[model samples]
Target: MAKIVDYGAFADRLKAAPNRWDVLREFHEEWGYAVRPGSDRWDRWTEDEHETYVRALSGEPRDEDGLEGVDLALPIPAALDEWWELPFNSFTHDSQHYETNPVYPPTVRPDPSGYGVAGPLQDDSDLVAPDADRRVCVFMAENQYCNEWGYLAAEAHDPDPRVLVSVDDDRWALQARSVSEFFLQLTVQRLPRTLGWSAEIYDGEEIIDGDEDDLRARITERMPELGFEPWAELQQDTIVYGGPDVLAFVADGELGGIAFAGRTPRAVLDLAERLGVKLTEEDLTEPGEY
Candidate 1:
């Protein structure tokens, strides 16, 4: 039967294996894109450039593939601290051949120093006395079928008392039967469905405990503004939960899609203004550092 796993206990097991890396390399060999070597953007082109690259990838008609015309670049180290503010726990897509898109920050090479392990709480006194009142951030984002794996990770990692979520408007279902179709898939496709989200907290699969419903109720009660409704009756809905922080949201015809950034509305607006980002639903794409 399906059940929640303790993230801490199973953390080490989650590290990528050498064979997994090889598989990713092969994937890149078959479907990789060209990248401009030495470029920090990882030589990845903008969303608009995907079609042009895919057409060439299919050998339908186009330009280069080698270092001169490389399609995608290999994964580079990302910094962990950079993602501290991101609500949902984040992971770099580890498709050996090419690095995953939507690259996360604090890009750094994995070190024995503990890339995924939890550290001490900032306040030692708090550790001596757990506070009943504290909050965490939950980040939410939209994804297609393939990214369900990444979405799963986002739900499992961050562990704070307070949970907040950022959303990527729904854009999962799309047609990509043909090799050329994958290009079109890159474009956001709003589907007429919504997802019921949830999460759990634990040290590992063995010691796992905590109900997503209870967590949701607690967060909503603390915030008192979002007025999130309970979904005990909505059993048929597909529920996603777990990660660094708990995340729960719905994406449907009525909800459209939402991408989460792990920040408060006030922080989001402040950063946007400082960065000259306008406050619109579309601005949800970059929900700020967290």
Candidate 2:
């Protein structure tokens, strides 16, 4: 599929994609995805030596029958249950970790030493007030160990409910209006960090140069579906372009930065060609995975 920035079409895809787990499973090829702890695909990490110390998933296999051992004070929502059944978690590390669904939680109460599938409020990370009354929220994912994102425990029945943020640990704020938006934001934001695919960066350092605005405009001209809004707020000024075969982003750092990720280093060469991005031998790889 051609990479496009058509905002209308993009919005339509986002609206329909939350319930489609099959879209991810279709990327069966490794695509150089960086392996994190507990991943069955750890070929690049530890030189193929899997991390054996990580404990097994606490509950029975995640399925539509309902998270088998994810027993919580509140009922589980159908949308969450559907997401939990993902064949494989594309994430490998803290940048977008959600590998283990609903970890049994900390051994002790109100102190978060253990994590994954749990929230920061339980550990007193100060996301909210220390003395605040605890609401029955079940966190499903975290970033770098503290920032957490989950649906309200009270609204477990909603297919797509409001998403909450604790920042692995926050005072509890609205992350997204619904699970669908949150998932797209998470996947898009983490694409560059976790997906170890072929890429080319136009880093202006005495070489060729292009301002972020021009690059952004050129990209927008090519894929108008994208918006000026940064996909991940944390990565300020970053605009994402996503498709089945490619993922790219333009951001402001110094002058500007743009990245294109493909199946191999040479894979992005095609993108540079199509986008009319100037490149030299230094920007091209030997036609295979880096």
Top-TM-score structure, candidate number: 2
lDDT of each: 0.24, 0.47
Instruction: Report the CA-based lDDT of candidate 2 relative to the real structure.
Output: 0.47
Candidate 2: stretches off by over 4 Å = 1-12, 15-18, 27-72, 91-146, 166-185, 191-196, 200-208, 225-230, 233-238, 251-257, 264-267, 274-276, 280-290
**True-vs-predicted CA distance for residue 286, candidate 2, Å:** 8.8
* Minimal lDDT window, size 10, model 2: 47-56
lDDT of 1 by residue, 58-166 (tens): 6675544222212122221121222322221112222122222332211111112332111122232231246422211112122321221011122123321111111
The true-versus-predicted C-alpha distance at residue 1 of model 2, in Å, is 11
Q: Judging by lDDT against the true structure, name the best candidate.
A: 2
